[model samples]
Target chain A: MLTGVVPDARYWSYTLYGADDYLIPNQDQRYGYNAATMDYVPRDTLNPEASDQWIDQYQIKISADQQEGNWLPAGNNKALSITLRLYNASPTVYENLATIALPEIIKVN
Target chain B: MKKTLIYFLLFCASALVGRTVAIHYLPDYIYSRFSKMALSRPGAAVNQFSVLMAPDENAKLVVKPNPDFAYATLFYDLTDGPIHILGAMPDSIYWSVALYQENTVNFYVKNDMQYDSDTLNIIISDDAMDQEADIEQIVSPEKTGFVLIRVLVAERDEAHQKAISDYLNALQIP
Candidate 1:
């Protein structure tokens, strides 16, 4: 399992890709989820306040098994990489790409 | 032995030539096909930006399809002058315009945050990147190229997407 968080921007999302840069095919037909696609997350899961846009603080979960809130299904036994895209990023966000850090991943019981 | 050596040399020469030609012309061929795809779609026409994806929808604009940002495209010719882009993005949404040369080189790109504009006013030209223009100028290395605009659709707001589409349709090179 892997997890990460992107800073606040007008819009931001992380997409998982195979070694070839193409999206990893999954049964759900979902590649990634942004703040706008909150409906994809299970109802009332995670921080409800982080409902829209890349909030001040939030974590995205990626794993083969189903997890709650912003669950990105990683294909079985396949190596994948994530691409984070920030649209209309502020100077604070874009300039601090190196300085700012993504959230740490923790195993789900 | 002599015949085999001659045939082998000829084959090597032919393969090298074929590879070079493919490398040189393949980009234009691919770009043309994708540019045509953007043009022939419904509501799309030359010089005007057309939204390829609808709200809450995903599609193949050219090859790889993305479900996140809504793609709006324009196939433009700079034989006349420059095409002017003028509009205002809705508040709290992310958007960007990427200008690609007809031969498929991405020459310039700017997002809503980076752009020096409140009401979107930018010029697209092939003359030069530093040309004298009252508004911000985007130089397309090729006289003719494709302009791709991406606007994020917020939630199930089809209305916002429609608004942006209408704004894009109203833009024309003058």
Candidate 2:
């Protein structure tokens, strides 16, 4: 899992890719969020205004059941890569971007 | 002869146990002492730092970046497992976080998606607060490992940078 804080008038996005570096199938279709109506929704549901605003806080969650192929290889193992981009909507360019990583994994028998 | 061999084996077992105890308990003892020092000393302004730990209540470490910029990281170690991070910035800036293997060179994960951009006169924004990317398939490859935390502060001032650093350092496993 990953989380970040974004200021006003700016936008942030999170995308997920399978171990093979391809877009994962979104059966629920609610994989991203924005500032105006910043909340988790199914991927299939489309927000008309999603293309027009910025998001303040974003959270990304990955579950074990949602994976198609073995992300960690054959031995009950897995690895994943994430790409995050931030865009400044104002004329004044923003400096370096800050990010925090939150690990969300538990082994439950 | 059998008695001599048994004594030797007993001595070796005792030595191994002592070594294991020292390795496991030494850092905790040192960390407590340092934490006490930090609290007793005159409060210095905070600096930029990163906190890494596992979601579990046991493994956690707070890392502060050196203000002098001479060192890339103020602290790091592998006495624990997994990795959790929390950070803060003083100014309005953008940042990205990535996870890499122990090699210190390659990033297994990177996040760089943005919602909008503005030109000289025209402004474009994407209300992406609701955008969700499916990450349920992601997993860590290592059985016992660590995660890296990186922060980028827009302004290079002392106080803001310190806050970022201090916050990261204060993170606890709980």
Candidate 3:
């Protein structure tokens, strides 16, 4: 399980890559979940115009089997790595890149 | 017994030499080959931008490409002279331009937030030239390298694609 608060940025995503450094091939054509695809709701009073919409938190699961929310396939017994990309990041995001709260990757049986 | 020991020693010596040579030359050879392949694509040439669609599993031009980004690439060859990049950012989108050396080290990156103006007038060269007014000059470490312009298109919407494409196409090399 991977969980964290989304960074304040115009775009963010978690992409899964296999040991070969190529995207893990899956049937759903789903390799990642970006800010738009994650379907984060507005944080402040459901106001779409509010600037904090991108700051909503997320929980993603990586498994071979189909999962409920924000799932990316683990691609059938292969070593994997997740890459997080932040585009047009805010000043805070850039400055605190090292100290920022990254999503915790928990191994669940 | 003596013959076998000499043979084992010879094998180890060759293995070390082979490993050393491969380690020293393989990355450069691979990058050179990759660059040649990239430049051979349709509409991809020296000093010109080749706009690419959002990356999918088959997109090998870059590793770990973000699907939400529309990319424009320039396989720059600065042997002749300095190359000028003139462009304008599309409104309300995340945009950045990054410079990479032939060895794949990203040397410079400028995002939209860093620029005060929507329009960009940048010059990339290997040598110092007479400073031109109203243009930002960047010295490149390699005469031949790559330029990447990334524009965020979160939804893959048609309007966003068109806008990004237009923005990339408008970059002039004069």
Candidate 4:
């Protein structure tokens, strides 16, 4: 399972790749999730006009089986890779790449 | 004692040979195979930009393709002469042109934020040419390599698709 706060960027996605570095082939044609395609809920319940209080948090379940929401298909391979791409990312993210807050990958049985 | 010395020498020579092959020959061989597969794609060729739609499960031309970005890829062979790339910057959130040698070494990359004007007139050659007033020059390390342009699409709606199409149409390669 992968969970974190989506970065404030123009575009972001988490694409799953096979051990060979190519994309994992699946029948559903679902390779990954972008900021536009992801399902997220705001942390704060502020007034509708207060856009500054909204924080988009997301969780992605990566497994061979179908999950409830934001399912990144892992196929049958146990050893795979996931690439997180952020386009037009904030300067903070680029400057703090070594200390940036990345999604936590929890191994779920 | 003599046999032991000979065995040690053979092992050292084999290790050195293996290291050289792995470092020098392996990457080039792999890149050649990859370039062959990439060039075999329909509408993809040297010196011509091939606009690739959004990637999915079937998109295997490259590794780790972002679904939100539309790509215009071109392979250039500088053996004959230089290649001219002229295009206007797309009004997208993020865009960039990245160049890589045949050995998969990234030589140059210029993003939207790095440019001041909306127009780009780049001359890619093996050696640097005289700087013109409004032209940018890129000296590729390899005679044959690849150039990739990435355009970000926040949404896959009709408007975004048309915008990408218009951007591609405006780009001139000569």
Please tell me which predicted candidate would have the highest TM-score against the true structure. 4
Query: Cα lDDT of model 4 overall?
Result: 0.81
Which ten-residue region of model 3 chain A has the weakest summed lDDT? A39-48
DockQ for each model:
0.22, 0.01, 0.49, 0.55
- Name the better of 1 and 4 by DockQ: 4
Q: Where is model 3 chain B poorest over a 10-residue stretch in terms of lDDT? A: B152-161
Point out where model 3 deviates above 4 Å: A8-10, A25-28, A41-55, A64-68, A73-78, A88-99, A107-109, B1-27
* lDDT against true structure, model 3: 0.81
Rank order (by DockQ, best first) = 4, 3, 1, 2
State the C-alpha RMSD over the true interface residues for candidate 1, after superposing those residues.
4.5
lDDT of each: 0.67, 0.37, 0.81, 0.81
What is candidate 3's lDDT per residue for A12-41, written digit by digit as tens?
Answer: 888888777777778776888887788554
Could you tell me which 10 consecutive residues in candidate 2 chain B have the lowest summed lDDT? Answer: B118-127
Measured against the true structure, the TM-scores of the candidates, in listed sequence, are 0.65, 0.25, 0.75, 0.80
Could you tell me the lDDT of residue B69 within candidate 4? Answer: 71
For model 3, name the residue pairs that clash: none
Tell me the tens digit of each residue's lDDT in model 2 across A1-27: 454555433654444444544444344
In model 2, the number of clashes is: 53
Q: Which rank order by lDDT, best down to worst?
A: 3, 4, 1, 2
